[model samples]
Target chain A: AQTVTQSQPEMSVQEAETVTLSCTYDTSESDYYLFWYKQPPSRQMILVIRQEAYKQQNATENRFSVNFQKAAKSFSLKISDSQLGDAAMYFCAYPNQGGKLIFGQGTELSVKP
Target chain B: SQTIHQWPATLVQPVGSPLSLECTVEGTSNPNLYWYRQAAGRGLQLLFYSVGIGQISSEVPQNLSASRPQDRQFILSSKKLLLSDSGFYLCAWSVRGRRNYGYTFGSGTRLTVV
Candidate 1:
């Protein structure tokens, strides 16, 4: 069984500041992939970033990046220069053997101006 | 560019009524289609996925069922609606053998069963 865990239920950050959302996962598969998705107030699920388990290099997409520690089974997302529009719920996901994703509970982020 | 479409952005149905939600993908063929449900303030739950037309794999056991009548069309149906079925339903797709790319999701449909 693969499980993703987002320990932080809610987080707040001031505009232009940086905030890090923590995520941990358990998977027996040696080679796999991970993803971060954002669901805003509009209720649309958007893909944020992706990281390959075999790559030691972290993935960065403009203002979003992930610190993936394969040994520790940790994958954390860092948002730089947070803006009001960045407020949303974030989910960490891992795929199962059949390609079905197992998602974390999610972290609701609020940006304070 | 591939795009996914889900219909009936919002729906309110009475309990015991039959239900059908349609999802279609454009600009892609033989894509893997999936149905997921999300409760308020919760993560997504995978309901069903299809590798090809008429090949459906159910992730969870429930009254809700899914079908893929065409290459890029997936339908979610229920013989009878239940209050527990009320939630936001999302449709997603990924390229075959490219699951690492993640899924492209639809805007989603909000269903409310009374």
Candidate 2:
């Protein structure tokens, strides 16, 4: 069984600053995928970024990027130029070959203006 | 482009009442469907997943059951609801491409059992 762990329960970032949420996972499979999802107050889960296990390079999406360390099983998400709208519960997820996502407990991010 | 939908957005039901939640996908075919439950302040719990019609896999033993009557449609049901079953229900799907990608989730259903 694969499990994703998000150590931070809550995080806060000032407007225009940057924030990083930590994530780690336990997986026996050599091939897999990592993802970060954001859920706003609307309760809609949106995909932020993704990293392939075989890819040594980190995944970046404008302001959202991931530091994917396959050896350590660590995948962290970084949000730059953070805005008020960036406030949401961020979840780190793992998807194996079987196609089911194993999600983390989630980190509630608050942005202060 | 593929999209997933789940309803109703919010539901309130009494204990021992029958429960049914529906999920459907559009713009895709032969996709993998999944049902997940999230307890308050917890991670996603895999309830069931279907690779094809009539091929459902159960992850956890519970009072709930799932059915895939159509290729893009999945349903979650319970003959009698339990208070512990109250949580956010999410439906997701993924394609069977060469490389596995992240899943696309629905808006999610908030089930409140009284």
Candidate 3:
């Protein structure tokens, strides 16, 4: 069974600062995809970023990036220059054999101004 | 552009009541549809998914059931709702073979079982 683990249940970041949410997973498949999703207070899930296991280069979106270590089975999300709107719940996900996503417990991020 | 719609945005039902949550996707055909549940303060859990019409897969064994009558219409139903079933329900869709693109989620439905 493929599983995603997010050790941090809650995280705090100051405005203009950077914070990294740690995520690790267990999977035997050599080729797969990883994703980070954000859910704000509105409860709308938003795709933040994604990383392909076959690609060695990390994936970066404007202010969000993922440190995907395929060998270590780690995929961490980094929010740079955090803003107040960045406060939300972050989930790390890995797809199973059937393409169904296995999500982590999630980390509640609080951005302080 | 593609869009997913799930309704009603909020629902309140008594225990043992019936449930019918509808989800529809537009601007795409033969997309993969999924139903997810999120308990309060928890991550989303995959309840069911469909690769094509009438081809539904259950990831978790529970009281809920899902049906795909049309290519873009997915429905979640339950004969008798349970208190444990009270939570947020989300509908999502993605390209059939494009798992790398991730999923596009709906605004989600808040169901409260009293």
Candidate 4:
């Protein structure tokens, strides 16, 4: 079984600053996928970024990027130029071969102006 | 482009009542469907998933069940609802393959069991 862990239960970042959310997972499988999802006040889950375990290079989507360390089984998400809209609950997820996602406890990010 | 839809943004049902949450996918075929439950301020819990029509797999044994009557439609049902079942229900769809992108989730339905 794969388990994702987000040590931080809540985080706060000043507007226009940068923030990094830590996530770690334990999985025996060699091949898998890691994802970061954002759920805003609307309660809609949106995909922030994705990283393939086979890819050594980290995944970047504009202001959202992932520091993926396959050897350490660590995938952390960094949000640059954080804005008020970035305030949401962020969840780190891992998908196995069966496409079932195991999610972390989630971190509530508060972007302060 | 693929999109997923879930109805009744919020549901309030009495205990022992039946539950039927529907999820449908558009602009895609043979995609993988999944159902997840999330307690207050918690992570998602995998309840069920379907790879194809009429095929369902249970992740955790509970009072709920799922069925895929159509290729694009997936339903989560329970004959008698429990208070523990009160949580946010999310429906997601993903392409069938390891190399495919991540899953696309619906708006999610908040079920409040009284």
Find the candidate with the highest DockQ and give its number.
Answer: 3
Arranged by DockQ with the best first, the candidates are 3, 1, 4, 2
Q: Give the CA lDDT, 0 to 100, for residue A31 in model 2.
A: 79
Which residue runs of candidate 1 sit more than 4 Å off their true CA positions? none
| lDDT tens digits, residue span A23-85, model 2 | 999999887788899988887889999888888999999999998889899999999999999
Superposed model 4: Cα runs more than 4 Å off: none
Q: Please give, for residues A1-113, the per-residue lDDT of candidate 1 as tens digits.
A: 67899999999999999999999999998889999999999989999999999999999999999999999999999999999999999999987778787899999999999
Candidate 2 error regions (>4 Å): B97-99
Q: What TM-score, computed on C-alpha atoms, does each candidate reach?
A: 0.98, 0.95, 0.97, 0.96
Model 1 chain A scores worst on lDDT over the 10 consecutive residues at A93-102
- Stretch of 10 with least lDDT, candidate 2 chain A: A94-103
| Cα error of candidate 4 at position B43, Å | 0.5
Which stretches of candidate 3 lie above 4 Å from their native place?
Answer: none
lDDT of each: 0.94, 0.91, 0.94, 0.93
Q: What tens digits encode model 2's per-residue C-alpha lDDT throughout B1-114?
A: 778989999999999999999999999999889999988866788999999999999999999999999999999999999999999999988886533566888999999999
lDDT over C-alpha atoms for residue B86 of model 2: 99
| Weakest 10 consecutive residues of candidate 4 chain B by summed lDDT | B94-103
**How many residue pairs collide in each prediction?**
0, 0, 0, 0
